[model samples]
Target chain A: MAPLGDNTNIAEEVMVAEAEKRPVSTIVIIIAMQTEALPLVAKFQLTEDLDSVFPKGVPWVRYHGLYKDLHINIIWPGKDGVLGVDSVGTISASLVTYASIQALQPDLIINAGTAGGFKAKGASIGDVFLACNVAFHDRRIPIPVFDQYGICAKQTFPTPNLLKEVQLKVGKLSTGDSLDMSPHDEAAIIANDATVKDMEGAAVAYVADLLSVPAIFIKAVTDIVDGDKPTAEEFLQNLVAVTAALDQSVTQIVDFISGKSISEL
Target chain B: MAPLGDNTNIAEEVMVAEAEKRPVSTIVIIIAMQTEALPLVAKFQLTEDLDSVFPKGVPWVRYHGLYKDLHINIIWPGKDGVLGVDSVGTISASLVTYASIQALQPDLIINAGTAGGFKAKGASIGDVFLACNVAFHDRRIPIPVFDQYGICAKQTFPTPNLLKEVQLKVGKLSTGDSLDMSPHDEAAIIANDATVKDMEGAAVAYVADLLSVPAIFIKAVTDIVDGDKPTAEEFLQNLVAVTAALDQSVTQIVDFISGKSISEL
Candidate 1:
């Protein structure tokens, strides 16, 4: 150790190189449940639920780790305000995402999880889709002034260059707080040609858009929305598979971001 | 302070009385913009933007005041995370409301603002509507397993007894982040018999539902969604008048809540 820095030229070069490498300090990945987060948590070798460090939990619970010199945070805002029971619904998803953003102030936010694929749109179970645009199909405001209300008024899409860089399959996604599909609703959703449906994507995207924070939503198909089996059952049955796929997608995304220099982003 | 509580007996009596009286220690009122909050802020004499005191800024900017011994907070989460230009959308409203809840942990949350009334549903401009049950006409999750998704599954209504005590003209509100409406959408909304439409009510209600926090949504009719004029134009033209009405409604609501004892609630 005493002679380690004796090579002045090499030490200086090493320090300069280290300083030149742009690092991603914080990247927040939000998911609805611990199960959805487990894969990423394990893959990233996170040993702590950051929420535990704070006796009074913050709005979002973050699990921190380091991957390839980049800081990674897997966040889960349980169904309750901070922590309690696991809750479902768009509102919960949106609130937790908001809390995560406020608390972490991360450089990038990613919502990665499972969704019901629209088979007609060539979506199949296990396929991962990157959101080109996210719309809330359930926002039905019936008025004469604005048609955008019926659809999520603020449809969020990744910037073109990011898409070119990520080079993932792009698909429009429709999100709502529903586990089942009705004929009329299905028609409306299909009419928009969305490739997938999930409870949280649109809500997450909506928050990111409002904050002007760049977000990428990656969802793996869990089941078909209108398949013969009930969506709840199908979703439950395929959670492990879907989560695995989602974990992979997130890992790739993290690698890509970690590989990039600050200037490139 | 003249040794206000010098006497142990009197202090005990006063403390008991205070404990018995159901005081709303924190009442969080969320509105989309400053204009919507103007009436309440003026009425309550909140001269300081609580954010100013923190310097670093809280998740949601809080305006402080007192109404009949009840703490009042008027909050707005502007665009761009915590601060920036005010944004009008479902996402912003939901996130801000969530942040407000996290920051204030208020005993009660009220979403006060203007909304579009459905003339066919017996609504007219300038009228105040208290939310009995809030549903999202736009959350049309047309799936088989979970019909609630299409209808915001948790359609929160004040306990029947509370509604009776409040004695306000109660109506069901449909919320979405849109300023305009189309004919088809209008018909669908009308079919649902929603009396009013606004951007933030449903989102707030959705959050309140998750937290099991009691929330009241008070809105003044700013325009008729299917009225002769465009909703945008009508909303802008009538904002002052509508806000005035909304202000009055919030005042009344506060008075009602302040007047109630914990037992009454």
Candidate 2:
């Protein structure tokens, strides 16, 4: 039997090649935070759809425009109107991704976000990673058989060519709604062999997989999980600089994705 | 301001009254487990829609039939094809609920399942509860203002008349995807004043709220979260008995809901 990674790569390659015969044209970039999204929105010259493409009363926002040969749409679950806080978590991310796919019918999805990295896994603040896989660390359904389902570990579209072309770090990304790691979460992350942790990536991956849309993840580290600093303090202090790094990485990705097919990536 | 209970009741009454002038004819029950759903399906004499009502290639199942004057439908995220495990988590719950609402167009949603209950909150195994509100305990955003958004607390439709008619415990429900509680999760649950904890209720509520569909949660305690017993062992030991209890309570509630308006409940 082939290794899990080998099986995953073979499956992804076949799925992507068979699913698309033309070069990827329309792309949806699902970003959870407004601060993390602003730089990319500006860089891509995306215009906000003030006409409200989503359902009425939802705080979801979509910015779209043509970038080179690709039609790029950046969708963010906008701030809660009453609380004035950006909606960031698995629920909001999955909903927005589902809605965006249904509404835009994009060829591919790119989940870009800021995350906490593990220094032990060779990560430092402001380093950008292209996730090879994504899984949930907090969804710990401990029942037999169901425990694996809780992880929901999914391989992102295998990008062997992209890995060769881009000089970005690649790692398994673990996602939970929490910003801070608990003992249980830490164990689960270690089990998943995750180097990066974020709130939205796996949820987006779930939606993308469900809808049979090829997806990739680009995560920028805002804080080091194993470092001796409070998560909230470190995250807030480094958010600006990390987001810029995320912007640069995502820009390069989008540039690479402009006229390439999924197989090429 | 009036007390939260009073305000919630008043607001719920107004929303229920305004949303539907006639009695509710269609109802969707979102249950996560087949063990919990089979009894209700039998009680309602629902026929499995083998023709596949949902999108193709998905493991979601829907059973529907008429119970008295009410069109009853039960939706569950079916077992994973590969692992043969029930897909139980916030992600699956949210997606299935969203899709069910879109497809069924039900007048109301009832999230019925087993949950771990706090003994400190006056709960015992097999004791059924009507969730007054639902929130997430594991989604710790930690950022100011956004922390509240992470909790995602939303009030369930107030069933004052039903509470008066039926003898059942009422409490707030805290949700996370984990079957076992982490210390951080326990803290968040306490902060939410939650007496019941489940994997799917808050997620169902989120989707229902987004779709403007009234949702009610009926939870039966399968394990004591704060008790001396291990959660998995206790949950497995109590599941069969508690599911029976859940079936009975849900039958009574459905009977009461039959031929009645949302405001009447």
lDDT of 1 by residue, B177-260 (tens): 546664544654666568888878877876665444567788889999867988777887899978987887688667777866
Q: Write the per-residue lDDT of candidate 2 for residues B34-115, one digit (tens) a residue.
A: 9999999999999999987675446788999988999999998988755778878898899888888878888989999999
Give one digit per residue, the lDDT tens place, for model 1 in A114-231.
Answer: 8888887888888888977777665544443223534653445444544566545678888766555655457657766788888788777766654445577888888887568777
What candidate 2 gets wrong by more than 4 Å, as runs, is A1-18, B1-17, B51-53
TM-score of 2: 0.92
- Could you give the CAPRI-style class of model 1? incorrect
- TM-score against native, each model: 0.70, 0.92
Candidate 1: residue B73 lDDT (0-100)? 82
List DockQ, one per candidate, in order: 0.20, 0.50
Q: Pick the candidate with the highest DockQ.
A: 2
TM-score of B-chain for each predicted structure, in order: 0.81, 0.93
How does the DockQ of candidate 2 come out?
0.50
